[model samples]
Structures are given as structure tokens and as C-alpha cells.
Target chain A: MDLPRLEAILSRYEGESWDLIPVLQDIQDAYSYLPKDELQVVSERLNVPMTQIYSVATFFKMFSLLPKGKHQIKVCLGTTCHLRGGGRVVESLSHRLGVEVGYTTKDMQFSLETVGCLGSCAQAPVMMVDDKYFGRSTVDKVPKILKLYK
Target chain B: MVWKISDETAYDTLGEEVHLTINGVTIRAPQDQSLLVTARQNGFEIPTLCYHRDLPSEGHCRLCVVEIGEHPRTQIVNSCTYPTQAGLVVQTHSETVLQARRMVLELLLARTPKAKLIQEMAAAHGVYESRFKTDDPEELCILCGLCVRTCREVVGVSAISMKGRTPDKQVATPFMEKSSACIGCGSCAFVCPNNVIPYTEKEGIRTIWGRDFELQPCNVCGNYIAPKYQLEHWAKITGDPVENFFVCKDCR
Candidate 1:
């Protein structure tokens, strides 16, 4: 949404070919998502290809094409989490959020994603909102956690 | 190089020649030339999908594998990227080579079950139906990446890319939407072996990547010249005036 901010971010990078990832990260940090227009400008400014930019943007799990929510909710679907009913937690979250796993809410409150592992197997069926983890999370406990984020 | 100039060969200009055998036929060729080109020059038919003479070789298709070395120590290598070495023994049609090619074809057949090129190739190899699973029966892209390579290496732009990973992977523009970066040269369409890239020319306008690019017409005969967008890009690249591209071959 802020076009001038993109120039500032672009100016920060050394314009080296390898700086593409960091440049994208900084842009995503400034804007909630990688705006298509900004990405096109980045391609032109850096003299890279849209195909390459898009490839990098989509390849990484951190980048989102659409505007991500203020809070990112990552549900762990690792083996331990799955056995402990990670699927049910995902279903509950999806039902509560009214959006699919890889989408943002209409209100831009939260965007949901399922990660393979969060490295907190001891806290199985874990869901993380930004950096805060909710361990041993159940369907009933999901609404309370959602309320805390809201 | 160019070995023959006028009436004689230039030995001094030639690279070092290396001796190799293909199916027991001894042959001498320039060292480090791709084994695929060397084999083809010696009249061997090695089936490949991703090789283009003008484009850089990237052995993406894995369809050109040939068995190297003798029995008990044989190895399969993609002949397109495999350079010719001295004393190198290659089997372009050994039973192992056929089996490797057959497996490659079978996997390609399963991936793009509807691609006619793969269908014909499969039939030639006596593979009627794939034993593997066909996730999308209508899928035609075998991910050979010829179009992707041609666009970057030749056209000199990334208007499209091989996006995603595995079954979800595809060649697409940014965000899979109409890209403004595309010059509509149709180079991607031209290089696509599967011929699945949909584009059409009507009147004098060329439509590709969901955008219309105006084609310049020659002044003399009124035939369609290259796309004005493409000509501009080429003008910038080659440093010739944009007007120079307006002249058709016949007029030139």
C-alpha cells in the first residue's frame, strides 16, 4: 500500500543478486505480504526476472502473496502432534477462523498455516500465534486462545 | 569449431580429438563435446526431450540416459550433459539403456498421461499404459523446463518460471496472473515441446500470457513482423534501432 516505503527498502539492499532473499524479507516485514506491484518494481530495480522473484517468494514458507494477518497461527502437524489430535485442532481452528489452513481471515486478524514440526513435541497438538505457543491445545481450548489473540 | 572453411579442414583450429566407442563402433570426435551430439553425429538415435541446439544443455528430462562402460561396471548417464572423454565406451541401445529409457518414459507417461508426445514415445518403446499412478489424467506438462530455459537463456527474461515443487510444481507467471513483464514474444510457446502454451495471432495482434501485443507489419508486403514489444526488448538488448526490426526478411 505504501509505494515510497518500497524504494526505501530497495535502497537498503546492496543490489547483489544474492540479496534477493533479504530484500524480499525486508519488504515482507514492511508490508504484511509481498505486494505484486512492489515485487514487479523489485524485479526491475534489481534487474532480476519476475519468474525468479516469484519462484523465491513462493518457495519459502515465510512469504505470503496475499496480505497476511497481524498474527500468524501455525499449527504443528508433526508425527507426535498428529497422534495427539493435531488434525482435530486444525479442523477446529479452520471452523473458527472461517478460512482454510493457508488463508487469512476477512478481518485480517490471523492467518493459519500447518507446519511439519515446531520442535515442541513435549507440547503435542501445539498451535503457535506469532511466537507464543499454546501446548496440549484441545478443541474447547481453541476459542479461549483465539479470544486472547483478538 | 568450424572444421571446414572452404575446400579443406583446419587442423590447427580444431580442438583435441578423442577416441570413443558407441555400441562397439570406434569413433573419433572433438574432446568434451556432449556425448549426445557425438552419438547423434555417428547416426545413433537416442530419444531426448529437453535438448535444444541453441539453448544450454541442462539434462532436465532424464530421457537421454545411455549406459556407459562395460558389463559389471556399467553406469547410466544423461548423454546430453555427459561430455565425450577419451576411451569412453557408450551403449546407446543396450538392454540396460532401453530399460532406463523405458522407466523414464513410464514415469513421464504417468505424470503427463495426456501428452501426445509422451504417448507416441511410449508406444514406440512398447509402453501402452503406465504402471504408475496418474494423479491428473489431463496433465500435459512433463516439467522438461525447455520453455523456462529458453525464456531465461535466450529471451533474457523471467516472464515465467518453474514454480512450486513436485506434483504441485508448474510453469507460471508471477502469482499465476497476467504478468506485465511478459513481452509476448511467444518464445516460451515456441520452445514448449508439449505445445501446451496457448497463444494465438489474429489480424496483426499476438495474444499470449493473457495479454495482447501489437505486431509490427512490414511496409512493403504487409506481412506480420515480430511483436513491437519484442522488437523493443531486442532493440535494447542488441542496441539496434527498433525501426530496423520492422523490415521483413524478404524486404531486407
Candidate 2:
């Protein structure tokens, strides 16, 4: 919906066809999701077909076409994390949020997803919100940590 | 344009010839032309499921695999993607090649158990049953990608796409919707090797990918020329008047 902001992002990429991921990433960052019309605009500007753009957007887990929440919570489910009650932590978080994994909250405040690994096994049962990683995560600490975001 | 690939490129002999031995028989063909072309030119038939001369060679099916180099250092390669070169020793019907092709056919047979062509091909390869699991017993698509390549490369519309990875991959319109970009050309259905893509034509309407298109009739002969949408697309591409395409090419 922010036309000027979309134009600014397009200018940053110089509309190169091969920079599709970074362009989509920047657009996702700017709008929380790749808008359909904006993607059409990208298709026209870069001379790349819409199907290809859609394929690339859907192929990468990082890019989302649907509207995502303002805050994204990632639970690391690596071997160490899983052994250290990561499953319980995610279940409790999914319960409290009343949102399924890979879905945004109805209020659009939080989205929950699980990652294969956060590469922070020392911080087993790790849950991350935005850029901040919460180590030694527990079911009891979910609500408290979520409260800090909004 | 239908069945035109056989005339255009069944055997490519235009470029400088390169000699290669297949099964101890010397075969000559244009340098850098695929080994499949050279082999077929020399009366050696290599079984293929995903090859169409008009489309880009993807080597997707691996049905035309053959053993290359010599014994003890031979490597199995898809002849559809491997180019012929001088003195390159190849074996089109070696034991290793037969085994590899049979295994590929067996896997394909399991994947598309209902496809009659696959059944016939498997029967020819001496594989009556498959050892692998069949996820969908009625699945006819072998994921050879001929339809996908035709849609993207030749049509230039890219209305359909090959989405997802193994076991989940499928050729589908964007978001599985009736795509606005399809142009109703029917190229996808035309290029499908296993004849899997659902397409129907009746009366004056042609249907595919969940959309209907009116087939244009030649003004002079009353013979159907093409889909109205396809003629419109051709007009758009050639920058000519839409009425110019209403007549069939022969009538014109």
C-alpha cells in the first residue's frame, strides 16, 4: 500500500533481474509480505515473468506472500534443543499464542515458526523474537518474553 | 507445428561431423550434438521419455542413460544431455546401461503405475513389477518436465510452473488458479510425454488447466485454426491485426 516506499526499495535494487531474492526480502521487510500488485510491478520492471517470481518467492521459506505478524518467534528444534524440552516450549508457546505454527496471530502481533537449528545449542530450548535470542527457554518464560515485544 | 520436431531435428548433421564408437560401432554426427541424436542417426535406438527436439534438452527422465568411457572407468550419463565428440567410446546397450535404464524404468513404473506407455516401456525392459512404493496408484505424471519446459521456453508465457521438490513436485498454474497469462495455447498438453495433463476439446471449445477457450475457425474452409486466445496472443506478439490470424495458415 505504501507506493513511495515500494518505489524507494525498487530504486535500491536498480531493478536487476538476478537480485530477485534481495528485492523480495527488502519488500517483505518493508511490507511484512510481498503484495500481489507490487510483485506484478516487479515482474514488469525486471522483465521476469510473474510465474518465476512466484516460484522463487514460494520456494524460499524466508519469503512469504501472505501477511506475516509484526513479531516473528522462532523456536529452535535441533537435537540439543529437542532433548532440552524445546518441544514442550513450542507447544506451550503455540497454545498461549492460540496460533498454529507457521501462522500469524489474529491480532497480527505475533507469528510462530520452528527452525531446524539456531546454531546455538549451548542455549538449548532457544526461542528468538526478532533479532533477540532467548536462551535457556522454558514454557514458564514464554508469556513473559512475549509480553516484552508488544 | 504438431509432430514437427521429428522433421526439424530427429538427426542433426549440420555442423562439423564428429566420430564416436557406440557398442564397438563407429557413428558420425555433428560435433557437440547430443549423443542421443548421433546414436539414433546411426540406427541405434535409445529409449527416451522426455525428449522433444523442439524443446530444450533437460535430461530429466534419465531414460536414455548410456555407459561412456571404457570398462573400469565407465560412467553412466544421460545421452540427451551428453554431446558427441571424436573418439568418445560409448555403449548404448551395455550391461551397465541396460541395468541403469531398467532401474529408471522400474522407478518410473512405480511412480506412474497406471500409465500404459510406462507399462509398455517397463515390459520392454523386462521389468514386470516395481520394488519401490507408489504414493499415488493413479498418478500418470512422471515429472519428465517436457510440459513445463514447453510452457516456459516456447510459449514464453510461463502461465504454469513446476513447483515443489520430489514426492511433492507438480506442474500447476500460479496458486492453482485460472491464470490470466495462459493465452489458452494448449502447448502444455501438447508436450506432455505421458499425456497426463488433463485436456479436452469438444464442439468449438477447447479446455485445459481448468479454463475454456473458443477454437477459431478459418473463414474460408470452416476448419478450426487455433484457440481464439492463442490467435490473439499471436497477433499481440507479431504486432499484426487480430483479423489476420482468423484464417488458417493453409487458407491464407
Candidate 3:
């Protein structure tokens, strides 16, 4: 978030096009979303176009431009999950958080999103809070999951 | 290097040519060109939706798939982006090819059921309709990325780009805000196969992506012509005075 901290991240890499993704990843690690001003600095320093950077950033699901909450909650909406009541899971999460997918709660505690697939079809109706995966999730279990997170 | 004696006329060009077979018919094709273009030129009737000769290939549609090489080693690839090489054997209408093409068409039909082009293609492939349920029945854009490629590669402007991922992906301006970078060329609309992009010109103003730009009136014919930014872009590119383009192309 600070200029000196951002510069320290920038100092580790040689200014090159190949370093763009890693640099952006580090920036996201330091600050939850990619900053416009820092992206411009990467563009100037790495001799890449800002548009190209923005294109790469938006193309991948791993990157986010908007600020994120402290805890990231991802609900799977793949074919397997969807057929197994994934939509209900999303509805439950939305009702609990008072925020839709791709939105962070007012308290900045949780950000919710839906992913196409989690490569874990065996665990249908799955949701991930931070790094832990919870399978066969139901509306009744939403409050208990948040309790453990807070 | 050996060619059929009867079809020597096909390889009359001076450049080094590669001999390849499509649908059991041997043909001479120039190296490094896309297989889809060369195959179509050779009368193979390969179908494509996202491919425009002027734009770079993104191969998002998966409609132009063709089987390459002899079985048990054949591979299916999107012919629009696949490069032609010497001694390459391709089958445009093999069973595997048809099945792959049919699946692509059916999936596309599921995404945009009302698209007339997709419907016709489905009928041609004997796919009446998709078995899968569509998330959006009115969806027209198949996310082939032709408009995005044309805007960035040909127009030299990154005003629009693809956002999100499959099934939920869409073409949008940066931040979904009014773009400061768009030149209002309408090339994106021109290249879109489905005509999904809603761009219109009326009353000396061009409307694209929910934004309007003033169109310059021709000095001689009094017709509202190109967008102001387009003329300025041309001037910047060719080092010509902006005044030189005051008259429209037809008037000049």
C-alpha cells in the first residue's frame, strides 16, 4: 500500500515483460487488488503497454482490480456442482452476507465469488473459505462456517 | 516433394509449396498459412465463425475443427489457427471430425439458441437443438473474441476487451466505464459475425458501446462522415493534416 513497500516488490524483479504476471501477483499479495497507479509504474518500468497489462489482468480469474475483503469465499458453480444444488448454496451465502457474488461485505470481513470449477467435482456443492474446502454445503451450515472464520 | 503428374498446375507458383491432402484429395498449399484458409481455397468447404482473414486467429469458436494425420495418431485441431506444413494429412469430413464439429455446434447452440447462423449450422450438422439447458437463451455473442481481436489488432485501440470467463464471459470496456481510448471506428461491429455489438450512426453522431462520438461532415457532399477521432487517428498515422480528410472518401 505504501510507495516504499511497492518499490521493494518492484526491486526484486528485472523490468521485463515476462515478470509482469509475477509482479502483479506480488502487488496483489501486498494489496488485495491490482492498483492502477502501480500498474502504470509496471508498464513504464517493464516497457509494456498499460492496455496489455490490463488485458492480462482481466483475462485471468486469479486477479482482481477491485479491493477485496480479508477472507475470500469461493462457491463452485461447475456442471457437477450446479446439478447438486450449487445455486442454493450461492443463494444462502448471498442472503447471509447481504452481498452478491463478486461483492465484499460492508464490514470488509468476507468477499464472495463464484468459480466455474474447482477441479473437485467429487465434493459437489462445495465452497472454499480462504484455503479450506467444505463439501456438500447447505444453507444451515453458513453461520457455523462464518463463526470459525471470525 | 513428389507431386501428382495430373495436378502439376496447382503448384505452378514459384514459392516453395507443401503438398497436403484434405478429405482424400491431395492439394499443394503454401507453407505457414492457416489450414482453414488454404483448405477453403482448395474447395474443402470448411466452416468458420470467428475467422476473418484481416484479423489474428483466437480459435475460441471451435467450429472450424479438422482431423489431422492418420489414425491411430490423428489429432483434432481448430483449423483457423493451425499452420499448414509439408506432408500434413488432414480430413475435413471424417467421422471424428464430424462428431467434434457437431459437439462444438451443439454447445454453441446451447449458449445462443436464437442465433440464426448457429441454428443453420446446427441443421447442417444434423443437430436440431442442444440437450443442455442454456443459462441465457437470448445470448448471441458466442465469445469468439473476433471483435476484441479486431479492435486491438487492426484498430490499434484497446477500447474494448473480454472480461470474466466461459459461460459468463462478455466483451466490455475497461471498468465498465466510459472509455477515454475508443476512437469510434466501428471495426468491432464490422468484424462481429453475429452482429451482436450494437453500433449505430445517426444525426452526425456514432453510437457504440453506449457512448456517442460526433461524426465529421464532408465539406463537398455535406454528408456526415467518419468519427472525429478516426480522422485524427488517420492524420497521426499518415502524418497528414486533419484538414485533408474534411471531405468524405466518396466526395474525394
Candidate 4:
């Protein structure tokens, strides 16, 4: 969060704009999300405008501007998964998490998101909590699944 | 395998070590190795599409997903790019992982109804048919990144890349036009198990390439018969104005 640390990081990538990816990655790695202060530091050190930094961060889904919860729930809304009730799964999760998609809980417990696909079609209606899969899920199982995290 | 002196010198300069646990199994990997590589090396099968050892891991295909222990709720991540940390707990095939994978396959199947690999994979998962309105059956490619990787690594030509993002993402020649660097190498076709893009040489007209060719079935037994585009392209390339060549071997 300090300007000096960010300046040190940016100095490592001197004369290389392409290194911006790794620099941003390092920042995200240190802090789960890109803080505004860090973004400002990166902008100042890299000589890139704050708007441009924000644009690049927002362009890729991987870079999150806000702090993500310790647990991130990504529901696959791909065509196959959607047909098999991907929407229902997200709805159930949103209702249970008390937050809409792309929002983290106040306690920093969970973040709900809808991803395009996770590439496993055998189990439709899939929801990934943290990094594990819960397949063939229904609204009924949402409570039990959420309880496991607690 | 003879080791060169230079190779030995390079190996001696190695630094740093990391230990990670995948599915409760502890393994030591070099600092540079990704979690996916470690898991695969240990015989844990993580499904992947955009990942190839020879090419840079694009991490577009979310197939090789794993749940890292640091995250409390299951988060589907592209394991191909996620680095392995010391004390990392990875769950490769949990129920959450399986469900997410199934949905991805289903969506791909619906997008490209004619893709044999998608259909076959779906069937293997007990998915008889997609519930969504099927896309035009002419499509074949699953946009799995094989063609893109082949072009970049083996072909040494970055002619094709992932054009769109997420559900809309697909491998295409630059600007979605026929690439001059293609060299008609057919490497993309060869690596594509789905037979999505077929190369055809017509007799006179410009050769039609990279489009999904219809494989007509045998009239007698109804078995998938011949590559319609191949015959058409052959006729056009050879300057033979022939229509009867469309029939399959049995029918002919």
C-alpha cells in the first residue's frame, strides 16, 4: 500500500511496458484485490494514468479492484450448464450468500460469481466454492454446502 | 541421452525449493513449476484444453480447475496458471470441481452441436442430449486452444489466437480472415481430433479451407460416409467439374 514499495516494484520493470502484467499480477498476489492506493502508486511509478490502470485492471476478469472474500464461489453459466440449471444454482447461492453475483459478503466469507464454464460437462449445474466442484446441485443443497465452510 | 557441459552448468545454477500438497499428497517441485504440472506429474488427471507443455499456458480453458486451501469456499481456478505454494492444499476432483467441469462441457456441447469430441464427452457423462437449443450442427471446433497452440509453437506462426473472451472465445486467424502465414500446413487439422476444420482443394475456384466440412453418411447403412468438402475441394483444385463424386464409397 505504501508508495515506496510500489515504486520499488515498478523500478524492477524499467523500460518494459509489457512487464505491466507481471507487476499487476504481483500486486494482486500481495493483496487479493488491487487497492486504489496501490493502483495510484503503480500509475505514478509506471507513468501510466490512473484511468489507464483502472482500464487494464477491469479489462481482465482475473484482476479484481475490490477486496475479495476469503472464499470465492464461481458458478459456471455456460450454455450446457445453464440449460441444466446454472441460473438456478446462482440464484440459490446469491440468496444464501446474501449478496448478488460479483459481490462479497460483509464478513469477507464468500464472493459469488458466474463464470463462463469450468469445462466439466458430466455434472451440470455446477458451483465452485473456493476451488472445489459441487455438481448436480439444487437449491436444497445450498445450505448444507455453505455450512461446510463455516 | 548425453548431457552437455553447458546443460550441467545451467542445472547447477538452480535455486529455491517449494513443497505443496495436492489432494492430500505431498510433493516437492521446483520453484518454477505450476500447480497443474505438479498434479499431472503425480498422475492426477486434471482436464485441460488451452494448456500445452510446448506452448505458453493461455489458461483460457478452465478445465484444469482446483480448489486451493487458502480459499475457504470452493473457487474454480484455471490450475494451469495458478502457482503452487509451500503448504498449498489442492483438491483436484472434488464434487465442486466435477460439477463445474460438467457445466463447462455442457455449454460447449450446446455451442457446437456437431463437435464429436464434445458429444462423446457429454455421452460419457450420461448427457444424452443438450437441453439448450442446439447451435447449427455445422460447427465442429470446441475452441480448446489446440489449434492455437499448434500454430504458435509447432508451426512457429501466431496466425491464430483466441479471438473472443469466455463463452464467445474461439480460435481464429487474425481478424477472422484466412491467414497468409497458414502455409496450408494442415497442422491445425491434424491436431484437431474433432475434424472441425478440413482442408480442401477445388479444381478451379479458390480453395475453401478451415470451414466445417459435412461428412455425409452412407446411403445403404447410414454410417457417416465421406468428407463432402474434401471432394468438393478436390474437384475445384483439380479443375474437374464433377458432382457425382459426392457419393460415398459404398454408394459409389
- State each model's CA lDDT, in order: 0.87, 0.86, 0.85, 0.70
- Model 3 scores a C-alpha lDDT of 0.85
Question: Which runs of model 1 end up more than 4 angstroms from their true locations?
Answer: A1-4, A120-123, B1-35, B38-44, B66-77, B82-97
Clashes by residue pair, model 3: none
Residue-by-residue lDDT tens digits, candidate 3, B2-76: 122212233453246789898888898888677887898888888888877766677988888999999899999
Between prediction 2 and prediction 4, the one with superior TM-score is 2
Compute the lDDT for candidate 2: 0.86
- Give lDDT: candidate 3, residue A98: 96
The runs of at least 3 residues in candidate 2 whose Cα sits more than 4 Å from the true structure, single-residue gaps closed, are A76-90, A120-127, A133-150, B1-19, B249-252
- How would you encode candidate 4's per-residue C-alpha lDDT over A45-144 as one tens digit per residue? 6655443455467658877878999888899999889999999988988987789999999999998899998888789888898779999888898899
Q: TM-scores, in order shown?
A: 0.83, 0.84, 0.81, 0.47
Best by TM-score: 2
Provide the TM-score of the second chain in candidate 2.
0.89
Which has the higher TM-score value, candidate number 1 or candidate number 3? 1
| Predicted candidate 1 versus true structure: per-residue lDDT over A1-150, tens digit per residue | 577898798888878778899999998888879998898788878877888988888888888888999999999999999999999999999999999999999999999999999999999989999999999999999999999978
Ranking by TM-score: 2, 1, 3, 4
Residue lDDT tens for model 4, B102-147: 8877777777887777778777656656667665567777777787
Per-residue alpha-carbon lDDT of model 2 for B127-238, expressed as tens digits? Answer: 9999999999999999888877788778877898776557777878777778889888888887776788888889989898999999999999999888998998889888
Candidate 3 lDDT tens digits, A1-150: 378988999899988889999999999888988987888788789976566677778878778898899999999999999999899999999998999899999989899999999888998989999899999888888889989988
Sequence-dependent TM-score of model 2? 0.84
